[model samples]
Target: MTDETLHLRRLRSPIGRIEVVGDGRAVTSLAIERDGMLPHDGEDESGDPVLDRAVAQLEEYFAGTRHDFDVPVDLHGTAFQRAVWEQIVQLQWGEVVSYGDLGQATGRATAGRAVGGAVGANPVPIIVPCHRVLGADGRITGYSGGEGIPTKSWLLEHEGVPHTVPASARPRATDVTAAELDLPADAPAA
Candidate 1:
């Protein structure tokens, strides 16, 4: 990382708390809290214009009053990752694209997995809109932000993007029991 000192600001959202990091001029990272913990280290500087603006825009986004972000960002990543993030940033508020489609957009039609890696490596999420990307079958394969799939699900639901949660990841019915299902008491648990 650069020797430049980073500034930080945190905001509360429906999904969880979000932390924004900046280097005076542009936003450098936006991290969503995972399990009530933020995974970034930065000085808690107040009145920082960049961080302030980013927080404002993010608040507007969560409030549903803003559909796009104009706050400047300083993304640090490999060339391929940059290319993927660039394309992702162009997606409209409700638009969705598959990893394969994103890979093809970056002129690497067969690099869906690689594209996923780049997408995961994105430092700024909502601003860069990496949550807009999905699996080839419009399913949420995974998410590297906040509480993982649940966090991504919240964002997708907010944007009204149609996506499917894998059966394994879907919440199981907790109120049902052997008696409710009229099954034998000795039957194997579901």
Candidate 2:
């Protein structure tokens, strides 16, 4: 890929520090730092408009003041990956979808594994809402952002989405039925 002028900004959030990268006009990527430290490979331009907007919106999201993001994003990825991310971005704050559901949405109903791969490859996790996806049984399969499964759990909790966390980290019983969680009848047990 050709090198482009990029701007970077880091924001501290409830989860951790997030590093946002933009190409002056639109956000390119958002990386959640595991240890509150981010690699400085781009110019730390605090005044770049796009970076500033992304950081502000993300802060609003973490504060529970923003339910959706409107900042412009220039995602670079394969066509299928882009398509998957597009569908992911349409997810509402409290909504959750399974990998199989996403595969169906993308017209690749049997490509759950491929859909998972695309979700895992999402460059902008929270912005695209990749954490909103789960396994077929409504279990959090895994996460490719921040600290992995724990980060996904925090995001799900923040959104009030009913999901099955690992047994060790679960706050409620794993056998809670859909009715108990107030989910649809067809929803998988939590």
* lDDT by residue for model 1 (103-168), tens: 899999999789989999999999999999998788898889887887787788778888898766
* Candidate 1 structure lDDT: 0.81
**RMSD from true fold, candidate 2:** 9.4
Off by over 4 Å in 1: 1-4, 41-43, 168-190
Residue 180 shift from truth in candidate 1, angstroms:
40
Cα TM-score per model: 0.84, 0.82
Candidate 2 lDDT for residue 42: 50
- How much is the lDDT of residue 44 in candidate 1? 54
